[model samples]
Target: MSGFPPAQIIPPQVLLGAYAQGVFPMADQGELTWFSPLMRGVIPLDEKFHVPHGLKRSLKRRPFEVKWNSNFRATMQGCADRERTWIDATILESYCLLHRLGYAHSVECHDADGLQGGLYGVALGKAFFGESMFSRKTDASKVALVALVERLREKGFLLLDTQWLTEHLQRFGGEEIPREDYQRRLKVALGKQDGTFHPPALAPGV
Candidate 1:
């Protein structure tokens, strides 16, 4: 996707304000750039969300222990562990601050081998803007996604912003809509009551 001019630093307030306006930042060539795609990718929070048949079987098997906000920094690191990634030191440090402020969250999968897969995102009002996810084991990240959707639904969240659609995300009913339509939906989500990321109903390892 296209982006604005590079920025060396991104403050927490500026980052949150950008997301609230349907914009997000990424690092390109070691500089932070902002983007608001013409076609936005969003995963439906309702029944339209699909859990693949094989993943459902894996879920029943419960291959990894699911946890929320246990190790958020680790989760972000996992997402940035790719050969090529947009998550730079500035992005990492900024989001970690958001996590500490209770605005960012992670859904993690762990086994005896330690952390295997997970996802992280920013939560504002009733919307959750998914940043990235990673998997070190088969179906680990997918299972974490399932857990995330379940938690969002349970918490009364309305929008699941995926930034852009990918084939992997399409398997779970992720769709692309024109920017205008996306902004409308985003407004509704932001106008609603804020959704709690960690409700009392969830324990340490849920």
Candidate 2:
């Protein structure tokens, strides 16, 4: 087996720098792949995003339901199961460590019978950095995100970083600012006191 088979450990400083620069690393078939997408996706705190009418109605009805910090491992593993994934054994373990510390967090959505829908990342600071999310049901991921935005706004969070933009995110008021602007936001957020999240990472004031 090649030396690459083992998950290469990325230093915390390196990962943090990647977050500051709006970039992240992933393993592409055992090779390190770095990404910084041009159009970053993010939900504006004050904007109204259009959720599909059907989903909105569904939310009013059964409301599959959303919660924070409830099943971190399941959500992370779900995100890692995509066709091509970066959350290899080493990376997953590292992020779990981050979760244990006061760094990483997950916002989870569940169905009527308590099945996971999707989840996103949360790193406290002026900025709440969002990682990837997935959904088993139609509005699962989207509703989960809406709840996150609501929580962030309530918590007095300064920046909500989504890294890069996407069309699905556009319907939810996501927009792309220049890289320089992004870096500036990150710099301040990283420096200022933004609170912390450890295991039992809960919504603000929880």
Candidate 3:
């Protein structure tokens, strides 16, 4: 797919505008490409939200200490440490800038060793565009996700846009809606944005 030329400098607000328009960026061979999928994947925060029995059990075990925005750079690095990733130096630097501006945030899971798993994304209005997640310990990322959803629900967020669905996300009831429908939802969500990613009280388990 073709994309707009990468700007000489990508300001954090520019990135936020892209997400507000329902598009996001990916890096390939040092160039940035934008995407707005025809079939968009999202995790509904409504009554249909489901958690697997195994993960629910893990939550009670309290395997990881969940933290928010404490180590945004480290969480992004962990997601990029994999063998194949779209998060290049350019993307990394830009997102770090966004985080500094409080428009991008990370939900991190840690054990005694330090950060074990986490995810990061951009928050605009009432929507969270989940970017990536990684785990060094079993259920570490899952626990982070649980905490993320609970927080979103508490904050009155209306949407959690995952961009795409995977087997990993499917277990949490990820579903795809047509672009038109997603755009409608996006419009409503953007209007409702409160300019905050501040999470509310976490669930009792963790």
lDDT of each: 0.85, 0.68, 0.83
Candidate 1 accuracy as lDDT: 0.85
Candidate 3 local distance difference test against the native: 0.83
Tens digits of per-residue lDDT for model 1 on 38-133? 999999999899999999899999999999999999999999999999998778888988887778889999999999999999888788899999
Q: What TM-score would you give candidate 3 relative to the actual structure?
A: 0.89
Q: What tens-digit string does per-residue lDDT give for candidate 2 at 33-100?
A: 67776555566777554566766787787566777767777888888878888778766766666665
27 in model 2: Cα distance from truth in Å?
Answer: 1.9
RMSD of each: 3.9, 3.8, 3.9
Off by over 4 Å in 3: 1-9, 192-206
Q: Residue 110 of model 3: what lDDT?
A: 88
Which pairs of residues collide in model 3? 125-193
Better of 2 and 3 by TM-score: 3
Encode model 3's per-residue lDDT on 139-197: one tens digit a residue. Answer: 98888888889898987888999998888998899999998999999989878544433
Model 1 misplaced stretches (Cα beyond 4 Å): 1-9, 192-206
Give the C-alpha miss distance for residue 145 in model 3, angstroms.
0.7
